[model samples]
Target: MIREPDGSIKIYVRDNRHPQVIERQLRNLDVRADVTFLPPGKDCREPRGTYLPDNPALLTSEPPAEGKDDYWRLHPEQIKPGQTFVYTMWYEEHGDNRMFTARYRVATGPVAPCEVVPGGPVMKEGPEGGIGD
Candidate 1:
């Protein structure tokens, strides 16, 4: 999650991957969000926390809002569109267990443009410096 100058958060993906089950679970848990952003490659990052202030994570860091913090939700204004953010893969698998889950940590940075692969339709390409095809 990249923090904007205004303190709003912007998650980036060339395009959106909507209607995923994770999103459904978030809704069930009362998390209000629009879409999921993906980096060019499957690997990407997740923000561990934000820096609004010494305690930007808590709304109370600024002003008192009863017992709850206004920033407690960590929801920022609008995520600047077209920015590309990604994840870093952390795989865990026991010697005997072939199954494993991959975790990611968000890295703050910018993603240059990219091009589509040749095997896919439209016969497109990505920016020379962009990650993944």
Candidate 2:
């Protein structure tokens, strides 16, 4: 986790383990986030909370090119009161390769616990390497 001079927060999750610790860290940063790491074939049900319209300016995957850290840059100020960020991550292994996947969601008001269920088929093409890829 890195806090920028402009008040934006950048997070890079190199290890998906210990999600509860991650949630606690984000909370300490004054960011309301619910982090969940699903098992190999599991996923969270949709509509876990009130959905917020997609806004790249508020939360984006693209990182600044010059930085060595490829973090998810977030403008927390853009997140209104009563809003919480939800992150779900999981990975699949094929032969010697592991494919990591992450999904981000925003919820307003009360956010419900993630309802575990079997996830859909893996994408034909996922990020080839780590997040920096």
Highest-lDDT candidate? 2
For residues 20-114, write the lDDT of model 1, one tens digit per residue.
Answer: 54345334444333333333233322233331123223221234357732221233322223321222212222342222122222222343222
Candidate 2, which ten residues in sequence have the lowest lDDT sum? 124-133
Candidates' lDDT values, in order? 0.29, 0.74
Alpha-carbon lDDT of model 2: 0.74
* Per-candidate clash tally: 12, 0
Residue ranges of candidate 1 with Cα displaced over 4 Å: 1-19, 33-89, 97-133
